[model samples]
Target: MKSTGFTLETLKAKVQALTRPERFVHILRVAELAQAIAEANGLDAQRAYLAALLHDAARDLPEEELLRLAPPENDVERSHPLAVHGRAARRLAEAWGVTDAEVLDAIEGHVYGVTPDNRIGMAVYVADVSEPGRGVNAEIRELALAGRLEEAYRQAIVSKVTYLKGKGVPVHPRTLLAYDAVLA
Candidate 1:
């Protein structure tokens, strides 16, 4: 609702307005981690934090509306339904008067995983996977605490890919590219 002052409360409000409670917690965690990564990468930490907090604002939308709202050329056209979050998020950003191109792009690109022209997007991308509550790779905590955040991210990505493969889910090409870039 309030777009002028980007406080944590405002971020939580924005996220809660659009997502479930559990999802809101993930956004908060990602926002915290995204801010840390932004600072480390010399980016606008505030912007990254806000972007991460709202990145999944539309992730749990109904499948039909999600498909209708997404861009036809979007990378997830043929893959998992979760890919629709990007296009939905971009539209929601515009509707909410989110002005910063970098922040909006961070939300739009959070699910796609390609190289971003802005550090805010990268921060959101990295934080989306590295957040603690995902519980996808809790064991990576050791490496993460050892100052190996990037390595932890790679291992997490590997675990995600392996899980997706086992479930017969088609892994997005962009995800694989991101994993390779991080591990390389």
Candidate 2:
């Protein structure tokens, strides 16, 4: 478990610089939610906070920068460059010396989903989708906070696909794979 030199104050400044005021607020909420979920589940609360803080670090970057940092790996990402922000955030976090694989995986997997075995990743993913103020996933948030992390993750991924399909958006391959992996 490698830790980076991100003091709470410094991390706030760093993340604030990486995204808009509103987006950073969302990050804060997710970080808080993730930390709570981690504490409930006996995971590393600080690690969960760190991963959530950096999860959307590149979400507000210009599309060109996003493409440069994380080239589209599939048609879904190619069609919606915003879809690659998670991977781009991973690249940025790596550049910033975040060496923990679990943290990196959480950041990268926050946008779509993560493998079920990555407990921290699943927590971050669930938090990202269910953080308070989203007003759309209170049930999922409750599930995560109650230590039903796997169930929360399953519902989150399934809801993502459901929402995307309802909007007629193409499901990201990785999201589909995660959904299947959770079900299987």
Candidate 3:
């Protein structure tokens, strides 16, 4: 459980520099949500906050650049540019001197079609979906927040799968398996 030296100021600065004002606000919301989840789940609140803050550090990049840096194989289609942000975030975390293996791993798997095995990963995964103010239907988000975390995770995965399918995008085996591993 290595920890990064990312203080509140440093984390805020890093996000503000990388994300637009609106996006930074989203990050703030996610951070607060992560901290809340961490506290409720008896995990490290600060670490969870950092991981959520940096989760989208590079989410605004062009799809071409994202594909060039970390190409997802057939098992993981490159249909979503948002997926590439995880790779960019990894690079940003390293450059920012983030040494926490848990934090780095969480950020890396945040959108890499992988299920988180650690507490930190699980926390960020939930926080990413349950962040306040997302444009997702209010009822769905409320249902996700109103029950046990495992139940919420299951719903989130189903929501993600349904959304991707509706978009006519290829669903990655890892994503499906990851969700199943937690939900089932």
Candidate 4:
């Protein structure tokens, strides 16, 4: 699907300029992983890569700026201001001439979680959590590489919830809903 007027290289440059050096590298890794997962799952690899590449465009934005760009829609999002970056990123992608619905949906849902109908969003979400650069265990990566995307996504969500609980951090309600939806 057509997403943006800019080429991948141009978009990469823009993302690099927008994020920290380390975050830029992580974005690249996520894109690589997303593309691999898409290929394995018979989805559009290019679209997955593009969505992953722009997924974190607003990740490093100041809290005030992020909130200004996209206000939190719930108590979970309000408590976890960074979670709103997904919405902000979607806005940024649109501003950059990305009009593809799938790509925008993926970007908007990469952080919190999307509806169960959004397979592209699930691919990006799982890739973001399981990319090599993130130090995710090999088993999770293998699951994605093996085309078991739903399993991998479910695992990632479980792990995230467990980690947050262990650290005494509040779990986002959307994450719990996603976990349930994926299980269903």
Please, what is the whole-model Cα lDDT of each candidate in the order they appear? Answer: 0.71, 0.91, 0.71, 0.87
Model 1: colliding residue pairs: none
Candidate 1 lDDT score relative to the true structure = 0.71
Instruction: List, residue by residue over 57-139, the lDDT tens digit for candidate 3.
Output: 88876677666655766545455556667767877787777888888878877673346356666667777876767766444
* Candidate 4 per-residue C-alpha lDDT over 35-135 given as tens digits, one digit per residue, 9 for 90 to 100: 99999998899899999999999999999989998998888788889989999999988988899998899999888777767778888998898888878
* TM agreement with the true structure for every prediction: 0.74, 0.96, 0.82, 0.93
Per-residue error (Å), model 4, residue 139: 1.5
Steric overlap count per candidate: 0, 0, 0, 0
At residue 77, candidate 2 shows an lDDT of 91
Q: Is candidate 1 or candidate 3 better by TM-score?
A: 3
Roughly what TM-score does model 4 have, to 2 decimal places? 0.93
Q: Give the TM-score (vs. native) of candidate 3.
A: 0.82
lDDT of 1 at 145: 42
- For 134-164, candidate 2 gives per-residue lDDT tens digits of 8889999999899899999999999999999
Model 1 misplaced regions, further than 4 Å: 1-11, 71-79, 138-167, 176-184
Pairs clashing within candidate 2: none
Error of 1 at 1 (Å): 18
For residue 65, model 2's alpha carbon misses the true position, in angstroms, by 0.7
Tell me the lDDT of candidate 4.
0.87
